[model samples]
Target: MSGIEYHVSLVGNDSWEGTRSAPLRTISAAAEMALPGDVITVHEGTYRERINPPCGGESDDNRIVYQAAVGEKVEIKGSEIITNWEKVQGDVWKVILPNSFFKGFNPYANLIQGDWFTPKGRDHHTGAIYLNGNWLVEAAEFNDVIHHEGNTMLWFATVDEQNTMIWANFGNSNPNEELVEINVRQSVFYPKQSGINYITVRGFTMRHAATPWAPPTAEQVALIGTNWSKGWIIENNVISHSRCTGISLGKYGDEWDNAETTTEAYHRTIDRALGNGWNKEQIGHHIVRGNTISHCEMAGIAGSLGACFSVITENIIHDIHVQRSFTGEEMAAIKFHGAIDTLVSNNRIYRSVIGLWFDWMTQGTRVSRNLLYDNYTSDLFVEVNHGPFMVDHNLCLSTDSKDMLLNVSQGGAYVHNLFMGAVSILPDLGRSTPYLRAHSTEIAGHHTLECGDDRLYNNLVIAQKDQNGLSKYDSAAFPVFMDGNVFLNGAKPCIHETAPLEADWFDPSIKFVIEEDSVYLHLTCQMDWKNQKSRKLVTTELLDQTQISKLPYEDTDGKQFRLDTDYLGVARDESNPYPGPFEMIGEGRMVIKVWPHA
Candidate 1:
């Protein structure tokens, strides 16, 4: 009683806290009484309630934190035994970012702060946490970890139908929205229903993907810069099993076409008032890294809304499949709609309709050191748009057809990559067809540079499917600098230096195993040239018959692999392991073990 400031025991019926044994009964009472630097300890138990408070003032620092005792452990748990209808309001909900947790909660009540429904199976229209200056880390305790097998489950009880969990609005059409910064980390956040901004979420896991809460005319998840939520960092998170995009940054408002154009076109339009629409000049800096996101119904990680000066690196994103239930468009993995000054590096993507699909935008992207494998349609699908991009040191593998690696126009640099795809082409397409230039440009008398200022060097292009083992396709105008590649049957230069290594695996039977106890695997292949590499890096392996493999391989220590297995997985490190040919490759490999079903 002398040193203890206050205590709240949900189990006790006492409303007063005069004695050490007679503590406050409710957490709400303890929060009101807590002053700055005051400690409020919650005993281990289940407290069913929804929590909301006003935004934090600058002068107030009376942080209400829920933590384990120095030697004793306490648990605040969600009730897993209740039905979705019964689990409403009581699963420990909060309005702002409060340091709280359930040490023993298995299926706690839904954490709603924004526009969401409640557990009574009613549309409660409440969000989980308001996320102002407050910081929230819904961490798992030793018991919770053991109960969940050591990973935070963003959403449980796989609803046979689709569902949404987290919804946010970054304030409509307010340029000053960037001033508000919110960081949501080390937890699992799901059901991001609408557009948001100025929020940085890292080391989190997301699931139960739903359609963007925009009009059918709006094809994107959310418009990023309508009200500039600048300085957003969506890094080191596992965003998976969603129906739409993994992460969409940098977009503007509605333009000419209303309905389908907005719903279907994930392009960056230049709003005259907004200064070149959604370019690097408008949006602030962004960093999206070390995430493993897959099973999206649409594109994996897309950047439209004119996101500028952004770096999307070291993420494992794939399995963007189109479902019949998805009545919209086919799914794409990594799309650069109207982005600029972007560096998309060190990612592994596979099993999607389109991988690295670039559309209309001024090009200044440095897309290098990525591994793309078995992209169902094409690995690099460039459209009518053009740029001054630098495509170097990437690996592309098992592209099913002859349309995998190419540009709609010859602009960006194509250097040092390993590309493997089908080689059989009919004269209907013709030999003079250019690989770097699109068919629309090739058929024209003399096409202007789609977006010139290009350079090519040290790139390897291989044809894994040609019976004659030819790497080069017959084209009228070959891409510049087609020197360092090798063809399978000595036909033309298709793939680069390690033609045999790529050709040997061209039949598509080789696989990199990621055992259940195996943590994660840093599977990298390097070519002979200065910065050359094999492109197709796939994460389709199944570990322990239950868990699936994705990308960014989490943190590594030499051969040890630590995947971003769950929502709260990505941890920062001082060094990077995969630095390129001249640099170190898989130097620090860490192992990650996940028992999802256990």
Candidate 2:
């Protein structure tokens, strides 16, 4: 044979020849006997089993590849026992509980019978029977049940929560040495424990228990590696109705530690003092892409700390129904913390607290081409310490109180984004004295902008009427220049400073004193300046630039003429007919000369 091929058959109907007609008994036997580069093929049937790597065994050097038949279906199930009350005392039954525990269970009365612990093994759910931790029980058949025989409980024994399941090494907490991976593709892994890692699960259909103790407690598919394995990939899976995220990467270590003062302290604390915390020492370049995550309690995808350089793209994440008590932590469809070089693009995120949230410390991040619609808060929020960002060409639509698109206190280029349905305008400080200005604001809608320098161009924004024109508190000043823009409805658009004057200028003397939205010019003649009686002649024939005698006003220093008028709210100024900066157009009787003075 090209490589060691081990065949496993759960039905026991096949022969022992290890071929199509004959296969072995269980997957556990195939794993135990198979060497590196071995292919373990299992027949179609439900096999209830658990996989415990040889103690202190590092399987990194050994690659075990397992697959089912091309068109056949196979399911490996765990055991489940149906019981009314659980039999355990002082065992901390009321310990770490999900929100569901508080719903029906009473702390003072009635001892609850449930699987408070998950066992060590790769438990699979197939056909009618679902696995509950190495034990086979039908969950889709029976809603409430706890079945366990030959089951091993997997939990943290010490007072330290991070001290849960040790990886490959016996006592050493290094991630690379004890990396455990569970690869389940085109299969089901339900009712799993919290402490799982280095898992590559793709193209699988997973279902949750009707009444399990809690959701998958730990990271569903944790791709954790300490200075050893750098990353893992979980792509193209249909995950829904889990208590937690469809796929979780990295580790969220314990919050408290007393290792600094104790003689015998946990390694997690020692690592924390040494510039690492719990699973924080592990570095993973995890990629979760092209997955459909919906109907979850929290966001569709979430990354914490050690999750760096991960790209989440082209995923349709919708219907994230978060409760009011989700608090500050539960806000975005995709939430990232302490992440670097992360790119979130070509995704649709809608109807969440915030569409895409960048939290903690993020650098070298890019958020582009995302369609965020009808979110309750700001569609895109870059919070805390995040910098060197490039966000562009995203469409954000919202009726919420915050901006449709927004950036806060961070440095980046915000441009070419269409803001509709009451979006806030980005602050324009492009020409402020000293350093170049930055445009910081959350954006909703689709338009493209330059990367380093923030410039908004070619964006179509349909906004509700700003009844007050513009807010007075906004102090940033910009000259009103209309170009390449179209405004609809009978709405008025004005800049942040004082409102535009609605009245007309009457006197040439007042034109210079008062600021007009439009430029004004005052023209005068030599005859009018010398002879005071000729002032009326200049005012009446101001439309006739050819008729008025040309002379320089004192203010013009003998080169230009100034207009004059005081009786009525009108000004008449003479201009050069030979074409100066100002041109007077109109003729005799009904003549009206308009001057555009530069």
Candidate 3:
């Protein structure tokens, strides 16, 4: 098919030709008419409709592109502006909206309920109220909203079939004058069907989506979701204020998200997924990059299907999984399941429940060159994977001692990472987990339940005073290899022995000098005992030679990724590199890009 360009504007008519002079009114109209190799340039405006593309492009070279006009501000919202309001009581105002305004699916009537979703004993809606670009706190009941004076909380209820009543406290400001917007739609940009390939959405502000919890065993939804599609590029957008997830790259459930309540149910779901073409040719291979995703209740970017064989890079994801009354296993800034051959690098994740969580069948993945700090929970959590994965060149700085790393998997290699806190290893020794066949997406073998046989090489573990060091639950049958790692500030590097006991590798007489004004934590190693250097105490040999072959990191397209340099773009020595993420650049440390200024 021949390629064409379409245009959309706020003031244009829907029946007009989608040209630069006579643009379409709604993005939904443009989505219906866009074909392969077409470019739909939306002008500066606020559109309040979901753009569900009818179909995707045939190939990568002929993909459809939906982008904001160059240097223009385009906001596609899931909300509608409201102005009519009346004073109800002290610091409270009420507004009645017609039921016909919602069309068919009303988010105010939809309560947030799903598997692993906690409502804290009250019914919470996907509906939200925003006043002048700031979101108000959602109240459980109308009485709670009336009684609450601080934070400008709000409450809404569907009053019969004719109208919906909303009560909110504007905090001494007039509700009629302020810009009030209510969530009216479920998503801003999403395809209804699965396997929509080679679609690109860029440079738009998508907000106020009423999304649900995205579990791996169920159909996952988000503000912008791939919906079990392949070869999608969702980049350079500002996505925020989602009720559940911001960006979803997940699978569609077999039966309306009625899966994943139990282990047997999840296994059945996986079997159905395999039958429905869950391989490299059918699913995954998405690129989500350079996006600023924040203020989400569940996750910044989450997926069960879209995360596999994908690249998520250079994004700023923060303030996620915060202010939710519910708790679950799938809450993080960047959470993924079945992330085989994926790369998550050069991103800044902070102030969330967990920084980066890779759960269940995370084989052949790499987490490198990321700056993770100020997280409420741990920086990295690797759960339930007998990995052939690598985690290297990351600056994991946590304020609490127990918030650095949590490892529940075996066969992972931690190399050249700066661990500024403690580490916890909790392995389940009851049941074995499934592993896929080598170089294929089929389940083949099962690794025995153990957390040992892991490797930690050339890492700098800086533990402060009165902080806990590396600890494990119990000793495993296999040993955890530790080599060329530096322990500073009286930190003890402990490992499990076969006798169900802990063994410390460092001596008590080691001293460390802390530099206060340094950006990087500077520590000078000092040993009080004679002829006992810090490197002499730890063995530099490999505990298991077979595990070394698993360290070849590959990207989503099956290309090998080279780690020849450190985090600061410094070259490493061929024989012996430095301990931490930075290879010693003269005297001071080589500084990498920590925060994105663009």
Best by lDDT: 3
lDDT of each: 0.39, 0.36, 0.75
lDDT string for model 2 (34-118, tens) is: 5545666776655544332221111323344455655555544222222222222221111222323223322112211111222
- Deviation in angstroms for 483 in model 2? 12
| CA error at residue 270 for candidate 2, angstroms | 14
User: Which wins on TM-score, candidate 2 or candidate 3?
Assistant: 3
Best by TM-score: 3
Q: Give the winner by lDDT: 1 or 3.
A: 3
Residue pairs whose backbone atoms clash in candidate 3? none
List candidate 2 stretches off by more than 4 Å. Answer: 1-199, 209-229, 255-274, 277-282, 322-328, 398-403, 422-459, 464-598
Writing each residue's lDDT as its tens digit, candidate 1 over 98-194 gives 1232232211233321111112332211011222321112222322212333222211221112232221222221213322222122122211222
lDDT digits (tens) for residues 418-526 of candidate 3: 7777687776765566677544568866655467667676676766554555545236445676656666655566553222111234322222222441133333332
> In model 3, which regions exceed 4 Å deviation?
156-159, 471-474, 495-562, 587-593
Model 3 C-alpha lDDT versus the unseen true structure? 0.75
